[model samples]
Target chain A: MSTTSTTAPSRTSRTSRPRRRLARFGSTGFIAALPFLAPALVAYLVFVVAPALESVRLSFFEWSGFQGAPQVFVGLQNYVRIFTHDPVFWTALSNTVIWVILSLVIPVGLGLVMALALNRKIFGRNLFRSVFYIPGVLAPIAIANMWRWMYNPNYGIGVNLAQLFNLPWLADVQWLGDKNLALYSIFAAFVWQIAGTNMVLFLAGLQGVSPDHVEAAKLDGANRWQVFRNVVMPSLRPTTVVVVVLTIINSIKVFDLIVGMTGGGPAQQTQVLALWSFQQSFNNHEYGSGNAIATVLLVITLIIVVPYMVWTAKQEKNS
Target chain B: MTVTAIPTAAAPVANPSPKRKPRPLSRGRDWVRVGLWVALLFSVLIWAVPLIFMVFTSLKSEADIFGTPAFVPPWAPEWGNYVEALDRGHLLTAGGNSLIVAIIKVPVGLFISAAAAFALSRIRFKRQRLLMGVIALGAMVPIQVAIAPLFQVINGLNLLSTNLGLILPYIAFGLPYQTFILYGFFRQIPEEIDESARIDGAGNWRLFLTIILPLAKPALAALFILDFVATWNEYSIALALLQSQDSWTIPLALQGFQSQFTSSYGPLNAFTIMSVFPVLIVYLMFQRYFVEGAFAGAVKG
Candidate 1:
């Protein structure tokens, strides 16, 4: 937190002047770093990188994950099955895209608004921040329980509100159980959990918007909204970039929430790609198809994140 | 303790608001304060009320749950629901397994990541950027992609359904984030310290062990608390690797409870309320870092 007050901490390394000193011992820089780096390197490669590569390879073959199963080479069949035949595949794919889109808008938007409002030197704001953030940290089981109660067909908020408002149909509406409303309902839960994260990020970003700058702008006859638009938003680009990237990644990688809450149920209505892939492999025993779905998810993430990381890394380095 | 602490550092009296010379308060300012309070209260409704409702329902009997309104607290609160859920859910066994995994994984993972971060930031060497990129990429790749292959690898090693199976991959996945955070902290420490220590004939190992680590305590503490929560709550890999119910973590066991809880809402809320206490306590303890450490990951690009 102390270091964060100065500037973005990640930028500090590259921006620091690279000072190479003549080794007192010998030309043994890599040799010296080896001991420090080897264990992590070996573990990461064996467990993370190699597995990812293996997933790509697994996608092209027909292999049940069961031991002693025949591993037959099926070129493009898994991918083709997902692309052309599986109606659920399209639903899962679109659901993923929709999840990503909704996530980027709702939580991030709410977070920015909360940050702007609570950025003041107000009393009790910290407690309020904790309230918003607690759900995000709570176990998935707890969150699922709360949201399920809200959306319960029998005794949920929908039912109670319907009763109070004299709207009979709302009570019948299955919030988590319905096909049409389920994905968005789960996203509402996501907003409840995630908005706090974005708020915290933007609050940290707002710390960088020097009060002096705002004061100077005020003296020069800039109004509040103008000052915010002109001074605050521009300086918040770095935080925004991070916020957006994290949002998209979280949306794409969203699995546990869907699994815990709905299990992609009510006749497989809320199945996003991540959950769909898990179902295909583990539940359905279509290992090749499952791996294919996984590969699709991996590519989507990389295509989005890699260039952004490179671009942002460059931006942080230069700025 | 208020505005003066941080603002005073850079405030040079050019600012309009001055506590030094008291002036007449403006009418507009009082209205703004009222507006801020309204907004804050509105945010509480959006955020805390559902959580409050969760607590309310957890205390209710089965009759009270369906008979009473959603928001109303029951007249007679019972702790028996919690006892029942705890007994039926097998939460103690699951919690113990989670604790074993997290306690081992968090420290072991942090140490390995710290060593790697030290070299990446401190040691000037070829292939630094390549290694850094590889680790950075590891953080973003979903665990789903690795689950199939990882299950095979764990199976091949005959480590499946064991704590060792869970700990190994958890460490691997946890390394990137911890290393990246520590690198940022370690990089900010002046290299002149490294040069001077080297001049005194201290090896790189000694320098890391004694000097750099002590200075990077804040980052280490923050990451330790954060990593513990992640390790405890992790589910995907655990689902793929853990075959037996005996070895299940909190999340897995909770999922098992979920099927039974679907039929009965009372015990479900009770179980959820009980299960979340550990995460809540830990979060509250390190919450300042919990809120602010989010931005630390932002610049990791």
Candidate 2:
């Protein structure tokens, strides 16, 4: 080899070696990140991390909020009250499960169907998709408020529709009153509000599916149902999983919909975990019990999310 | 494999290529497909009914809304309902508050999240990975649970009943997700550019401002819109932080309007329509970017 070429490799190796090795250890590039990370670190510590730690600490102390310093440290008494004593806690838990299941099923299933339909060469594809997704883009408070008006019995659509058919809609039977029907009524509103965005997500996933594979399936004499089962459904499974997980998580955190629609009303029948925690901590002035509920909610959310995250991470590695 | 053996099947379509003859559609099969579409359309209408009802109620007079013939208003259409709603509710003031927050929040949040994401992407540090993990985990926790202590923390800082108070939490709540997104984008840009810049003696800030920021403009714009929409529409925090009427955001004020005027659906509906207009306009303007940003970090391999 020429001396010049030989010298080039030696210099190249020397210069690139540190950068490559640093990338491997992921440690070489530190200075560039400092300015950006500093502010975020401070804010996270103060606003997010501190509050989370305080919640754990506050769960043990019995207090009526800022009224006075916590009178006593009950130590697990607050937690025990939830599992053993509080019927409301159990109701909220059950309501949470119901809400999660409903949210997961309706939004994902409807979203899939909507995506498939909208994916066709429809004349007004953009218009239709945009209209369906309007609810999701509108702020949550606005959508919830709109739904609240629609559910109003007097001069509201529900009343007018019921009167058109001569049925007692909101007056005789409490849409918000009956314990059995109350949760479902609130759920109906949620499904409407979320189905749009979920549909958009599913559409993106469907579009990502390779058209060649779909064409191959069609050429193989697969019927509509057979094609859907063997090709489209499997192709869409990952998107479905994403949708389901997000839906379930959002359901657990549901507050605005219930607050706007019913305020967990007619009785405590409609109260989910988020609203329950807010009521206990803020409204009822029971800080310890409220924190206890929040802690359990946090744990439960982790229980669902942590495993799924680990599983997905492993799946990503294997794939 | 037998068709039945394949439990998960994709819908099959007949080939429409000119080289291949199109398969005949049996009458029965065609009828079944049409029937399904009809059923689906009706289901969609059922879903749309509540929204349609809201629009209709807003047009009717109070007497028409109350009278025996509830379907038919006693008089003609009422544009006055909107005027009355504007007068009754502090709709304009509440809207102004929402606009101010969204306007302020977008740039601040984009700066914070984008800056953090840029650092995490460009620089290598062990602490960076750990910090990223902490943020990911925090995203799973519900914000509602954090409200009580968050309020306490804000109050301790003496920001209560101020726009700064609400703005602080809004930015904090939005940071993680926005960071997650921008970081993903920043990392995608090849490191060759950075190395070339270093060779030319571009300092860190100059490289970022000149080379990196311009390239990352699309991602920043996307984050701005997403943060704006989230902040503008946010309620639970607004309700908690801003106790006074002057500080109430649009959503909070709208809720207050509903309770105050139990009999008047016109103004309430009118208020709903007005409040949603600005959001809809923004959405329409930057819609392509909004959809792209939303699904960007979400579809991680």
* Candidate topping TM-score: 1
Deviation in Å, model 1, residue A25 alpha carbon? 3.0
- Residue lDDT tens for model 1, A1-319: 8878766765675445335452544423788899999999999999999888988999999987889999899999999999999988888889999999989989999999888877765666667778877777876555766887778788888877887799999888878877898988988888998898788778777877888999999999999899999999999988898789879878888888888788887788898888888888888988899999999999998999899778866876797
Give the TM-score (vs. native) of candidate 2: 0.87
lDDT of 2 by residue, A1-319 (tens): 6998889878767656546744544334566567777777677778877887788788898888874465589999999988899988988989998888878778778877887777664334455566667677676666777776666655456566676788774345556557888788788778888887788777766756778988898899898888889998898888788788778778889988888877887678888888898889889988888888988888889899888877865884597
TM-score of 1: 0.92
Fraction of true inter-chain Cα contacts (below 8 Å) kept per model? 0.60, 0.54
| Pairs in clash, predicted candidate 1 | none
Please state the Cα-based DockQ of model 1 relative to the true two-chain complex: 0.53
Q: Give the root-mean-square deviation of each candidate in angstroms.
A: 5.2, 6.4
User: Which runs of model 1 end up more than 4 angstroms from their true locations?
Assistant: A1-22, A316-319, B1-25, B292-301
